[model samples]
Structure formats: C-alpha cells, structure tokens
Target: MTQKEPAGSVAAVAGDKSSLLTMDFREKSWIKVQKKDGSVIAEYIGKPGEQRQLEINEPVTIIVGFAPGVTMAFRGNPVDLAPNTVNSVARISLK
Candidate 1:
C-alpha cells in the first residue's frame, strides 16, 4: 500500500490476495511491477526515499530503472539485487 502519488508517480494493481513485494527507493528512479499475464500492478517514476509494499498473491516481474539506490524485500526477506542487474537496471522475477 502507498500513501501518496505525486505527479509522475505510479503504483497500481489489477488484483491480489497472498504474495508480496516491497520496495524502498533511496534515490529517484523508475519502477514497474507486472503480473505474469503482462497486466501492470504498479508503474511510476519514484521520488527519492519513497517506499511501497505490494500484496502480489502470485509471482510477478519487477523492473527497476536505477538499481544503484533501490532495495527490495520479498515475503519479508531482503532480496539480493545482484545477479539480475545490468546497466543499472534490474529485471527481477519474484514469487
């Protein structure tokens, strides 16, 4: 859940129930989350220091435009941003 969406910020979901993904942005960046069927959950240019928690209920793809200052936790555990990063972007598939 998010508290606010300033201009240029986007966070949404088509449906939900059980799974979860949380993001904490330490710097300005772009972020998008999508379900397996390609439906967008959240898509936005995040302001620095913003944090979001998504209740996924299933697996999803998360795209991070600037990997350098973003951290994520899935199902209450911290995720390793390495191994999936390229050119400062990260395309992570989480369940």
Candidate 2:
C-alpha cells in the first residue's frame, strides 16, 4: 500500500518552492491585452532584435478594466501602460 504524504510536506522538501509562486506580477513574461485596432492581442518573449511573437485571433483581457478608464489605470500604474492610452499590449521585463 502507498502511504499518503502529509499536508505541504511535499512542498517543504522542494527547494525554494517560492520560485514556483510569486507575488510579483511584474515578473510574468507574458502580456495579454487588447490592441488599438480592436483586435485581440497576445505576445511571447522574443529574440533580442525581433518583435514579440504575436498570437492572432486570441481574446485579450483589458488591463484598463482592472481599474477604471484607460487614463485612470495608466495613472494608477504606469508600469502597466502609458497614461491616457487605450488598447495596447506592453511586454514587462524583470531582471
């Protein structure tokens, strides 16, 4: 018979399991947001010179909606996007 592991015991044994979870949303390597032309937008990290790889026809979440208007959201967190801008996807890097 197989013995059940205690609660969180497995995670305890794993080294720096905190890396698996982060409170820093800025560290996320992905961007999901709508575009200026009303097209869905998605991008993946790309080569040094190449533009981010875009995924067409994918539904993107509106970061502006997270707060209020585009202006407000940007003003609230310029890190997310430029102030007064609408429907744009920006890649955030953490290094």
TM-score of each: 0.75, 0.20
Clashes of each: 2, 0
Q: Could you give me the TM-score of model 2 versus the true structure? A: 0.20
Distance from true location, Cα of 88 in model 2, Å: 13
Off by over 4 Å in 1: 1-18
lDDT of 1 by residue, 1-95 (tens): 84564676333444432245777889988888999999998897777889887776557888899988888887567888878999999999875
Best by TM-score: 1
Query: lDDT by residue for model 2 over 19-50, one digit each (tens)?
Result: 12121232323334555565645433322233
Q: Evaluate all candidate structures by whole-model CA lDDT and list the values in order.
A: 0.78, 0.31
